[model samples]
Target: MGIFKRVKHMATADTNHFLDKMENPVSMVKQYIRDLEEQMGQAQQALAQQYWNERRYEAQIEETTALIMKRSRQAELAVDRQEDAIAELAIEEKLRNQEKLALYKTQHEATKNQTAALLEQMKRMNEKYNELVLQKQNLLSRIRAAQAIQASTAALQPYDMDRVHHGLARIEEKVWQVEAQAYAGIKAGEVLNAAPSYVEQEKRDEIQKELAALKEKRGTV
Candidate 1:
């Protein structure tokens, strides 16, 4: 049992390490952006529905206002005709419609306020999303610069001073021999010219310039 437990623990540790290695910051940030986009879409739908509710309340309020006015006029006409029961019924309906109009107005105002709140929330979320995008860009730029620097550093490592000096010594000897031959040919009335040797310093300078440019692009310098 103890051996089995030890094996299980080792397996778990290895799995965790593998999972950690698989986690990429850039991919994670992109996924977060996608999630935010989905949420924004849902929020927009909710806002649209809220606006619909506000409109529905406004329509109800208009209908209630018209009913109140109609009931009031009906009550007046019934009184003029000496129909007391009809007048009473119209007055009751007028009062009921007035109450409904007030309620509808209150509901409409609340819906409008909720819509505004939703708009503000969406504004804040959009701002946050933009900020995350900027951060992701900066992170990517830095990663690329780091990778370039690492490769350049590795390439330079093999060309250390000892190796460089040894290589230069051989080239210098070869150049000296070439010069001696050229001088001998010249003395014999024959001109001999050798092409220039490769310049390692220029290549080193170019690599350095490339590194500096990458740093600048990454905003590190």
Candidate 2:
């Protein structure tokens, strides 16, 4: 309604149009893929770290279980030797190792589950990313087809073709006029050459007069 408002609206529209033109599908898709790859890489790294923790927990559980067995054997030997102090110490160490083994086992199971879930998530992301790539290819093919059709349509525009035809018609008319002029000149030349010349007709008439005079002179008129 207002001039300033109209100007502002026009400017915004123009900016949006410019941005749309600048937004190339290929570049946009490539950027999107790059971002997806980055995220996937980060996810993979985190999964790898999780797997490392699980392995560490497993190693710790194995070591702790071995220590617990060793302590139990040591406690039994001490008891057989009637060494109460050594047996008590071995029993305490076995209990601590057992606790450590339990904690390690729990952590290992939790980490293993988390790693499995992350792997499934990563698989889904890869599938989706592949689908996006295929869609990009399809989009490009359609765009190319549309561009070709648009170019052909532009070349065959009726108004442009009409102008071409009009130019050809003008040239044809000029050629016809030139041919007509040449034909007219040939006809005129033929008519002039077909008739007797004035000088030749006069010469014939003079010869006839002379013959009549000669006959009269001879008295054979």
Candidate 3:
């Protein structure tokens, strides 16, 4: 009866609602599983006891049937010997044995039925406990998945577009400064290469003088 009461609790419990309300659903579910196992153990013990009782009743019935047979034989022997009083007493004992046999048979049948019912109940409870175990595994998987999603979301929450854009802007500024320095160095090299040396200036002056002299000689001729 107590096991049935606990099984009723298991059957009526709302796992989803219960987990939703609990701060630690996993631990609570573990405890619930333990309770169910304990109740199942008790039920197994009770069923075993019922089976023992059924066997006892069967033995009693067998013993009573043997007694009935023995008394019948005694009555027949007494009648054959012409012992009228012994025959009557034997008949009476046989009738009492018959009554006892009937009672024992009835008890045995009743006990057998009781044992069967208990076995059915235990089978049902085992199925329910297995169902709960599967449900617990599913709930745990879902809980772990949810926790993983939450962790990923929390880890990414701090990186807003503004911060990302600011970092990119800094990198771009550095690149622009490098480009400007390179361009300044190239321009300085161009200026230094375009300037003429003193020897080249002197060579230019001598060429101009020779051209002027040639022009004057041609005009005189």
Ranking by TM-score: 2, 3, 1
Off by over 4 Å in 1: 1-23, 158-221
Candidate 2 residue pairs in clash (backbone atoms < 3 Å): none
For candidate 3, write residues 53-172 as lDDT tens digits: 888888888888888888788889999999889989988988988888888888888878877766777776777778778878988899899999999999887658898899999999
Model-by-model lDDT, in order? 0.78, 0.78, 0.82
TM-score winner between 1 and 3, please give it. 3
lDDT value for model 3:
0.82
Better of 1 and 2 by lDDT: 2
lDDT order, best first, reads: 3, 2, 1
Per-residue lDDT tens digits of candidate 1, residues 1-221?
A: 33224323322333223324556867766776786676678778889999999989989998898899899999999999999999999999999888888999999999999898778777766776786688679768988999999999988875478888999999999999999998888876532222122356677889999999999999999
Single out the weakest 10-residue window by summed lDDT for candidate 1.
Answer: 190-199
Q: Where does candidate 2 stray beyond 4 Å?
A: 1-22, 159-165, 195-197, 211-221
Clashes of each: 0, 0, 0
Name the better of 1 and 2 by TM-score. 2
**TM-score of every prediction relative to native:** 0.62, 0.72, 0.68
TM-score of 3: 0.68
Screening candidate 1 with a backbone cut-off below 3 angstroms (N, C-alpha, C), the clashing residue pairs are: none
